[model samples]
Target chain A: MKILSKLRASIAVAAVLILSAVMFVDINDAQAEYGDVVINNYSDGAGMRPVVFPHWFHRVRFRCKVCHADLGFKFQAGGNEINMVKIIDGQFCGACHNGDIAWSVENCNLCHSGKPGTPTQVHESTVQKLAQPSGAKK
Target chain B: MPVSTFRAEFLDTVSGLARGAASPGLALFLWLLCVGAAWAGEWLPLANDGIHDPRSRAVKILQQPREALQGLTPDHAGNQVRWVQVLEKGEIRPREKLFPQTVVQKLDLDVILDAKGGMPAVRFPHRPHTEWLDCVNCHDGLFAKSVGQSKISMFKILQGEQCGVCHGAVAFPLTECARCHSIPRPGQSKPVIPAGIDPRIHQAIGQGQK
Candidate 1:
């Protein structure tokens, strides 16, 4: 009777763990789209949430030259060293996010709306849907 | 002091020392070299430094283009550089983040532009370009997502507009016609141009007028 009770308790614990895992996955998958980039290089360590950059959102208003050419952002994800310091200094996201062009950086939640522990990377959905390039950097 | 004025005054002072041990002209040359290096250090920062300062240590060496672009795949024509092949072969991998991490998300879509007047269709492959670029690089400004949106013409291109923005300048020169005008149109359906295609391609080829 005692052994059976122990086995039942373990099974109950395992079920809860599995259910929570599924719920956790569902939370991360909540609102991401094709070109959403999750940046968590410093967020987890800094005790803050990761940043999810929406590429299509910015593409609507500005030309590529505004950011990629004029602003000098590289093609690679997490390629540019974007920090709170740099953003505050009227460079990168700061150029537009500085009150006049768009919302000011004072609104932290506007950009840092990402999962807690997501790693820094170009979102997989954007690449996986498309075929990998012939001689892409590994 | 102004460079020209300083040069004139220095030369006047050193004219007496021209026949002396230090070869005054050579000393002036060395001084000018120092000045140039100082300016470069201030303006052109190290690659590891500022984000905009793109100068690399390897690129700073005297023998450049020849030395910097060593050991890469060669192309048969059009600037003689098969960049896709070199990147595929992994001659160099750019860092997405510092300490050598790289991520290249490529899309595999091809947009074909139908040419009129017995011309072959132009196939714009997204793979090679998207391999090194983000979608924002071209969309909404350079070329709209919708077909027939941008007015692309050979005349505009020759004048450094449309595709000419990169092709003639950074990418292969526009002289290589076969590279872009690759796809042959299928027979006899009146060769309808796609909705999003730049109409100038058909107009220019059909009328033989750019």
Candidate 2:
């Protein structure tokens, strides 16, 4: 009788523990929303400016393969080194900024004039909106 | 009276022993049940880690294709590797020293659920899949350490989620099930091909699984 009683007690305890565990299992519904622009810069000894690139905006205009494959981007930032000087010289962004496809180099306040920390300024949105040919009825 | 008392004592002892054995068995069963329950909800770990980052490693090494191939190949020493397939899906493309295209590497798995809720055995191709995609593509972030933890489903796949990130769009279309399934229509029912009687093995060897 004693042994039977002990067995029943142990089984009850095990059942309780299992039931508690099952009941307490946390169901996490947390989801993280990261920004589309992932720019890891590796230039400028004073620490490189973070490139605030809106991927959705650019993706609307160009396919991933264009800049990634054709333009020879290394699939990640800081892999294929890009600098302001290179863009001004028609190497990186300058490839299209020859006054036809994008704003000419004479329009100096385009990409270079930002105060670095401010991701978006009044002039930034204005220039970005006007830069695209989407509005122009060609 | 003494005889009757002895018989009574004997009966009680036997009953006690039976009870003792039963209690232990019951305790063992409970222990096993607890263990099984604990095992049920454990998950595989799939997190993005530094080792998985392809671009970082690829850029650092920047070894020419030939140099990379030469390091890995013994028979094909001094072999010039062609191009690395970024996210391609296909059978292993056989090549000698070098080719116009290199094979992408990624795990190719065929899964079938078994009865009793046990994990189904999976046929996985490890080498070729690694060649095509970057290590970061699946290792840490995509797949968890434990199997079946990802909660991956066909619904998510058709929706272009989870593994769909590459399969339908970048990798081979899942519509081509034969690539992973390998078995012909007649043999689909049997999970494993019997030794010396299977035809798919012959086909795989003949085609080099390309």
DockQ for all models, in order? 0.02, 0.02
Interface RMSD of each: 27.6, 19.9
- Model 2, residue A96: distance off in Å is 2.1
Estimate, for each residue in B132-157, the C-alpha lDDT of model 2 and write its tens digit: 44444555666654566666664665
Q: Per-residue CA lDDT of candidate 1, range B1-210, in tens? A: 223454456555554454452433344444444444333222121122211112322223212232333244443222234555655566545422211233335689888877655556778888777755556677876899877677677677765567865565345555545567666567733344457756533332232111
Per model, the share of native interface contacts recovered reads: 0.01, 0.01
What are the models' TM-scores? 0.37, 0.26
- lDDT for predicted candidate 2 compared with the true structure: 0.38
The sequence of per-residue lDDT tens digits that candidate 1 reaches over residues A32-84 is 32244667777668876667675434533443445675577765557687889
- Backbone clash total for model 2 is 20
